[model samples]
Target: MVIFGGAGDLARRKLFPALYSLHRNQLIDQRFSVLGVGRSERSADEYREIVRDSINRYARVDVEDEEEWSSFVEKFDFVSLDVKTPAGYQRLREAVEERERRYTIPGNRLFYLAVAPELFGPVAARLKEGGLTESDGWKRLLIEKPFGRDYPSAEDLQAQIAGSFKEEEIYRIDHYLGKEMVQNIEVIRFANTLFENMWNNRYISNVQITASETVGVEDRASYYDRAGALRDMVQNHILQILMMVAMEPPSRLKPEAIHDEKVKVLRSLRRWRGDDVKRYMVRGQYTGGYLQEKEVPAYRDEENVPADSDNETFVAGKLYIDNFRWSGVPFYIRTGKRMEEKATEVVIQFKDVPKNLYFNKTNDLGPNLLVIKINPEEGLSLQINAKKPGTDNEVVPIVMDFCNNCQEESPEAYESLIHDALEGDRTFFTRWDEVSLAWKFVDPIRQAWDQEGADTLTFYEAGSNGPKEADALLIQDGFRWHSPYNPRTGSVVHGSPIGD
Candidate 1:
């Protein structure tokens, strides 16, 4: 495997750690070799030293094996070459050719772009131009998120890379799709007859996917300022999750089949335009406050961020999929930075009974909920009507639990994605149709927001749920977001931070 930008923070922090785990598990063998390519002046040994410290800190090591470490280090080598220069490409090509000859391994190169988004096109063009990827085994490219800022740019990016690699050969990855729980999303909804029966507009009242972050934008402030919460979080992550929940059942478990279904949902998304955008959407920014036992700075205080920036630190919106399965149902997605608690999960709110026999019985003890926990902690819990303890004809909500993470070892998102790439499994990768539909659907809200401007970018203090706007978003519909943190009890009328 040829890992581009191997010395960068992403490569060191996530890519190396995941690859090491793959090695330790014996999933990869001596036949496999990883070439770390970057624009750095470092020898093979020097690069190994850099990787050794990274693996030690990030890898989940077990069964102390010195020999294993030594053997893994043997695969750790580097080629100092920038993809920007022609000479650099030649040098990189020569180094990879030698490795191929030495190992007698098929050049099944997996070009992973671990660098910044701006460099994605250059590296791709150089790889194709240098003829480094022309060899016997399958060659593939795994590109990361922020596929594009919007519709036109995303389409342009697709066109630029299409010349170098075929659509099937190019693997566009969304890490959330690689997640253990996220993968099971398809199974949870389809494999089970119970979930399928109640997944329609009749039983489900509202669906909420909240991805909160407790930390502020300490780094990447420039990027966040331009994209904000909607472009960064909603356009990709939240929409993807919504598709997982609301997509129609596929006839087969094929990549095209899965992606086709998702695209349909994106097409069916509620059309928010003109004045309706502000009515359905809510946006906010964080004020200065404390989090994680320390005083932290606000968005303005962050480096690279403008003092008068109107970019939103938070966004909460309601999505109405105009389909038979989800006509009346509303999908709510709220994401923000530096609020209070750190967590991520999905809450499926079921419709209330025409006459609540339980409301009078349990003193309005909240409606029944079927929550699918995604991260920080991962699990499943369903609320059912039950009789109150030591009561006659009185009912309350009780939960039945299934925690997937407690007993099962969930593979990291990168592990699943990288392995899928190597095996040529496109089931987990996104298609252009999916990407285009997502951007097109989000474009209107984005345009509407940009047109009106942030006349009311409410500011929420740190260690609180988002601004009152987020609450009012759901309250207007006579529903509430279930606080996954306090699921054992119920939704907290109190505040909590953003994360996942």
Candidate 2:
């Protein structure tokens, strides 16, 4: 493995930890080795110390065995290089070759570009120029998100990289796709007779996908101010989750079949224009408030952010997949930073019964819901109406919840993705067609925001859910966001009664 930004935050926090976990689990053989490339000056031994520290800090398992720890770190080598220059590529190539020879490893290489988005194409081009892309074994390129600012820039980046790597050799990483619940979406739909029969507009009412965070832009103001919530979250992570939830079942469970089905979902997304943009989308910024009982700064007050910046910290919108299966069903999505708690979940609401036989007994019966919890907690919960134990005909909402992560810790997102890259499984990775169509679907909202300036941008308290307009977006359709069940309190937050 060749990591471009060896000393960067991502390498320290995610990549190294994931690699260490793979080693601890015996998933990779002794022939596995890593060549760290960066501009910072460091010897191989010094770089090993850095990896040791990161593993100890962020790895899932502890370093209990001294011999195993030493053996794993010994496989890492570091080389100083300014990747933008051709001369640096020569040094990188030499380092990679020396490590492969010393370890008696094969020529397979996984090039991980953890640097800035602008460097993605240039680094690949340099690798090809230096004869590093050719090998006796296989080669792959793994890229991070924010693929481009919009459709045009993304297309240009794709063109530049296409000169060196083919579409199949490129792995576009959307970490959300690596989550356990996200992968289970396909199984829950195709493997179950109950869900597969009603997974359409006829029996389903609406779908809600949410990814909220309580942390503001701590150190990424420069990037967040420019990318905002739309490009940062909606264009990649949220949209990818939407695809998994709404895609048609593939003919087979292979990568190509899955990718084709996902692409169809993106192609069917409703395109928003002129007046539709304002009517369907709501954007907001956060103001100072208390989170977890501690005071926090507003988005504008954050470091490196302009006082009057119009960039959206929160966005809520409605989308539709204009296919026969989901013609009238609305897919509502919202994501933001510094608001409420951290969670990423999908809510599938089933339609109410045609006639209410027990309406006179109790009108509190809630709509049946299938909630898929993704982050911080991994579980599935189904809400249904049931008779109270002691009452004659009293009806109330009851939950059948199953917690998947309560027994043992699951693999991190990076761990699963890195293993797949090594084994050449593109099942979870996004293809070029998916990325291009995602950008095309989101470009209009971005352009509309640019033209309107900050006039349409609203504000919400940092610790609150979001702007009131966000709720109105759903309420106007006679629907509401179903808050997830809170395990700590044994209740749901802001839960509305059925038929509200």
Candidate 3:
């Protein structure tokens, strides 16, 4: 494994920790080695110590065995390589070759780009020029997100990477798809007879997917300001989850077959332009307010953010998939930083029964709902109506819950993603066409925001459930956002039930 940004935060906080856990579990082979490329000058022993500290600090599992730690560190090698010039690439090549020969292992190489997006093309070109991809064994390139800001930029990056590697050789990582519950979307829909039969417009009324964060962007202000909520969250994570919920079941569970189904969802999205952008999308920036009983600064007041910046920290939109399965159903997506609670969930609100036989007119029983909890917890629950105990012909909301948080610990998303990439399982990774189509669907909205909707930046208090206009986006359609503000309560709080 060759990591381009070996000393960066992601390498220390996530990448190295996941690798250490993999090694601790004996999943990584003894013949496998890692060559870290960066501009820092450090001895192999020094780099090993850095990795040791990182593992101790961030690894989910214990790395306390002295002999095991020593064995793991022996595989670590570092080379100082300035990506700007070709000379450093030659040195990197030598380091990899030496490790391959010393370990007596076949030259199966996995090059991971954990650096900024701007350097993706330059590094790939240099790797090719230095003969890194000409190995006798299989070679794969694993790239991190920010896969271009929009459609054109993504295509340009794709062309540049395609110059050195084939489509099969590339793996674009979206760690959310690696979550256990997200992977279960296929199982819940396909494996279960009850859900598979009703997973369409007929039985489903609206689907709401929410990924809200309680913490503000502290160090990531610069990047977040430019990317905003739409490009940062909607274009990748939210849309990927949407596909998992809306896609047709694949003929077989192969990578290509899954990709085909997901791509179809993207292509089926109703294109929004002109007034549709304003009508269907709501953008907002956070203002200074309380979060978790403590006050926090607004988005504009954060470091590196312009005082008058209209960059959106929150996005809520209604997407309609113009297909037979989901023709009139709306897929509502909402994401933000510095919101009420840290949660990632999907709510499938089934249509209500026509006849209210058990409840009075004023106390109308709600529709049945299926909630898939993804983060801060992992589980599924179904909402049903039941007779109120000791009451005469009264129906009340009741829940059937499956709590995934009962376990002590679950594997991090990065762990699964890295493992799949090593084993050549592309089921959870996004393909080129999927990325392109997502960008195509997202570009017009972004362009409209830049041109006319910039002033549409409404302000919501920190730690709140976004601006009220988000509620209106759904209220107009006779629906509402499903708020899991307190997942521990096991209650699905609709937007109307919670007032400011």
Candidate 4:
């Protein structure tokens, strides 16, 4: 493995920790090793110590055995070089060759580009020029997110990288696809008779996919201000989750088959333009407020952000898949920073019964929901109507829940993705067409926002759910966002009852 940004925060916080956990679990072979490439000046021994510190601090499993720790870190080597210049590629190549010889390992290469998006093309080009891409074994390239600012840029990046790697050899990593519950979506649909029969517009009412964060842009103002919520979250992570939830079952459980189904979902999305953009999308920025009783700055007040910036911190929108299976079903997606709780969940709200047998006594009954919890907690909860234990006819919503990670911790997203890349499995990675289609669907919204500026942008309190217009986006359709889970009560507080 060759990590491009060896000394950066992503390397320290995620990459090293994931690699250490993989090593600790004995998932990788003994011949496996890492060659970290960066511009930071550090010897191999010094880099090893840095990795040791990162593993001790951030790894899921602790370092309990001194001998094992020593053996694992010994295989790591570092080379300091300017990634932009071709002169440093020779040194990097030499270091890689020397490590393969020392470990008596085959020349399989996995180059991880963890640097800025601007460097992705330059680094790949340099590697090709230096003859480091050719090897005795298979080679792969793992690219980090924000593939491009938009469709054109992403297309250009693909063209540039095509010089060094083929489409089959490239892995576009989206961590959300590796989540436990997200992966379970396929199983819950295909493996279960109950769900598979009703996973369509006939039995399902609406699907809400949310990826919210209780955080403001802390140190990423430069990036966040430019990317905003739409480009940052919606274009990649949220859309990927939507694909998993709504895709048709593949003919076979192969990477190509899965990709084919997912791309169809993207292709079926209804294109929004002109007045539809305003009617279907709601964008907002956050203002100063208390979060968990502690005061926090607004998006504009954050460091490096312009005072009058129109970049959206929150976005809520309705999407339609103009296909037979999901013709009239609405897929609502919303994501933002510094709002409410930190959760990534998909709520599959099933249609109400044809006859209201219990409505006369109970006034209203909650919609049956199959909620898939993805982050902060991994679980599944099904909400159903039941009579109160002591009452004859009083009906209430009750939950049957299954917690996925209550017993033991699940593997981190990076861990699963890295392992798959090493084993040459592209099951969870996004293909080029998927990325391009997502950008095509998202580009019009961005262009509209740029044209209208702050006229279309709204503001919400930092700790609040989001702009009222967001709720109105659904209320206008006679639907509402599902009430979030209440930690103290261990139940989902019911929102407005679904209208007939």
Candidate 5:
């Protein structure tokens, strides 16, 4: 494994720790080795010490075995060489070749790029130019998020990497797909007899996908100020999850088949323009607001953010499908930073009763909802109608929930994903076609936002739900935001939760 920017925070905080977990599980052995590459002038032993400290700090150590830790450290060595220059590529090639001979391993290589987005192309060019990716064994490339600042740049990046490896050789990591709950979306829909048939327009009314964060962008201001919620979360994680939820049942469980169906759903999305942009979507930038008991600064007040920055911290939009399965059903998506609560979930709202015998009476009874919890507390809950506690014929709402992770400790998102990468399973990874199609669907909205300007980019206070425009988008369509202000109780869930 060649990590281009091994000295970076992503490597130390996420990659190395994930590798440690894989080592702990004994999934990777001496047959595998990690080559940490950077331009820094650090000796191999010095880099190993840095890795040791990082693993100890970041990894969730169950055994805490000194011997095991040492063994893991021994498998990792650093190479200080520039990825852009020819001489630098020579050093990397020699180091990898020497390692392969020492371990008597085939030339299979997993080039992991944990570097800045701008460096991705140069690194790919150098790797291909140096013939490091040429071998009988498989050559794979794992790219980090921020695929591109926008659509055109993303296409260029793809063109850059595809020059080195085929589309199959590339794995686009969403991290969300690696989550135990996210993967369970397919299982919950397909494996169960109750949901598969009703998972369409007939029984379902709406779907909501919400990914909210309580903390502000502390140090990520530089990146956050540029990408915001749409590209950072929606284009990849939200869209992928939505595809899994809304895609038709695949003929087979192959990754390609799954990806094909996802592409279909993305293509089916109803295009929004003119009044629809104001009615179907909303954007907001958070001003100075209070977080918990302490007052948190606004985006402008953040260290790297400009005072007049137009970057958005919140986004909410409503999307529709033009196909038979989801023609009338609307899918609402909202994501933001510095919200009242930190939660990620999807809600699926079922159609209202055909006959209202009680004549719109108010009580604990409510619409039947299937809520899929994606994070914080991960699980599945079904809201069903039952006989009221005392009343004879009156019905009330009760929950039949199956919390998958509550029974067993949930695995970390990266833990499961990294395992799949090592095991050569791309089931949870994104394919190029799906990525390109998703970009196609989202590219228009991004272009419109940039060209039309922020006349529509409203501002909201920090720790608020979102701009009123978001609420108006839904309220005008007979819906509202699901703001869980208090974590202790369940709120009325109208917006689709899991598949919503």
Candidate 6:
């Protein structure tokens, strides 16, 4: 494994720690080696210390044992590279060869780009031009998101990498897909006959997938300013989740077959144009307010952000697929930062029953709900009408919960993704087709925002759900977002099953 930008925040914060966890779990063998490449002027021993400190601090598992520390650090090494020059690539090649020979490792190589997005294409091109990619064993490239700023840029980046490696050699990482619960979407659907039959427009009313965060852009002001919520969240992570929830079941569980089904979902996405774009998509920026009971500044007030910046910290949209199974069904997605508790979840609202047998209930008997919680807490729950605790036989909503992460700690997203990459599993990685189609769906909305300007860029309190317009987007359709905050309680609300 050769990690570019080894001393960067992502490398120190996520990559190294995940690698350490993988080692601790014995998922990786001693014959494997990792080479950290960066411009930092540090010796191999010094770099090893850096890695040791990182693992000690950020590793998911305890790695304080002297023997274990020594054994793990022995396979760790570093190389200093300017990244732009041929000399840097040559030096990287030497370090990789030396480490492979030392550990009797195979020619197999995994290149991870944990550097800035701008460096992704150049680094991959340099590796190929430097002959580092022409190994006797398989060579794979695992890249981080922000694949491009927009559709054109994403296509260009794809073309640049295509020159060096084939489509199969690239692994596009969306860490959300690696979440234990997210991966279980397939298992929960296909493995169960009940869900398989109801997983369509007939039984399901609407699907909502939200990934909200409580922290504003602190250090990523430069990137976030340009990317905003659309490119940053909706384009990759949120859309991928949508596909997982709405895609057709694969004939088999193989990677290619699964990808094909997912691509079909993307292709079937209903495209909006002209006035419909503004009607369906909404954006917002956070205002100074409290979060976690502490005060914080607004998005515009954040350092390095322009006072009048129109970049959206919040995004909510109504997405539809024109496929036979999902036709007329709406997929509502909302994601933002500094608005609410950190939660990632998928809520499937089943259509209401034909007739009501009970009367005088505390609240309206709502549609059945299947909630798949993805983070902060990991679980699955189904809400159904049940007999109230009285003899009158009134109906009330009750929940049956399956807490997936309650008994044991699930592996971090990076841990699972890294392991899959090493095992050469494309089932968990996004292909180029998915990427291009997602960009296709997102580009027009971005262009519309650009051309029409930010006159509609609304504001919401930092600690609240989002701008009121986000809620209006749902109300306009005669439906509402299933509150992901506390689905177990009576706070969950349902609206008309057939949307306006």
| Number of colliding residue pairs in model 3 | 0
| Candidate 1 lDDT over residue span 196-234, tens digit each | 999988887788899998988878897899999988989
Q: State TM-scores per candidate.
A: 0.94, 0.98, 0.97, 0.98, 0.94, 0.96
Sorted on lDDT, highest at the top, how do the candidates line up?
A: 4, 2, 3, 6, 1, 5
* Tens digits of per-residue lDDT for model 2, 1-500: 99999878899999999999989888887898898889989998899989988988898899999998889998888889899899988878888888888888788889999999999999989999999998898889999987989999999999999999999899999999888889889998899999999999999989999999999999999999999999999999999999999999899889999999999999999999778989999999999999999999989999999998999999999999999999999999999999788999999988876554655334445788988989878888888878889998777788888777888888999999999999899999999999999999889999998999998799999999999999998888877887887554567433543354
Please estimate how well model 2 matches the true structure, expressed as its whole-model Cα lDDT: 0.90
Query: All candidates' lDDT scores?
Result: 0.81, 0.90, 0.88, 0.90, 0.80, 0.87
Candidate 5 or 6, higher lDDT? Answer: 6
Model 6 residue 312 CA deviation (Å) reads: 0.5
> What's the TM for model 1?
0.94
lDDT of model number 6: 0.87
Instruction: Give the worst 10-residue stretch by lDDT in candidate 2.
Output: 491-500
lDDT of 6 by residue, 189-302 (tens): 989999989899899888898999999999899999999999999999998999988889898889999999999999999887778888999999999999888999989999
For candidate 2, the C-alpha RMSD (Å) to the true structure equals 1.3
Q: What is the lDDT of candidate 4?
A: 0.90
Q: What is the C-alpha lDDT profile of model 3 across 317-336, one tens digit per residue?
A: 99999999999998999999
Which segments of model 2 are wrong by more than 4 Å?
359-362, 492-494, 497-500
RMSD of each: 3.4, 1.3, 2.0, 1.3, 2.9, 2.1
Q: Kindly report which residue stretches of model 1 are placed more than 4 angstroms away from their true locations once superposed.
A: 356-365, 407-409, 485-500
Provide the global lDDT of candidate 1 against the true structure. 0.81
Model 5 Cα lDDT, one tens digit per residue, 408-455: 667677778777877788888888777777777777777777777768
Q: Worst 10-residue stretch by lDDT in candidate 1?
A: 491-500
Clashes of each: 7, 0, 0, 0, 9, 0
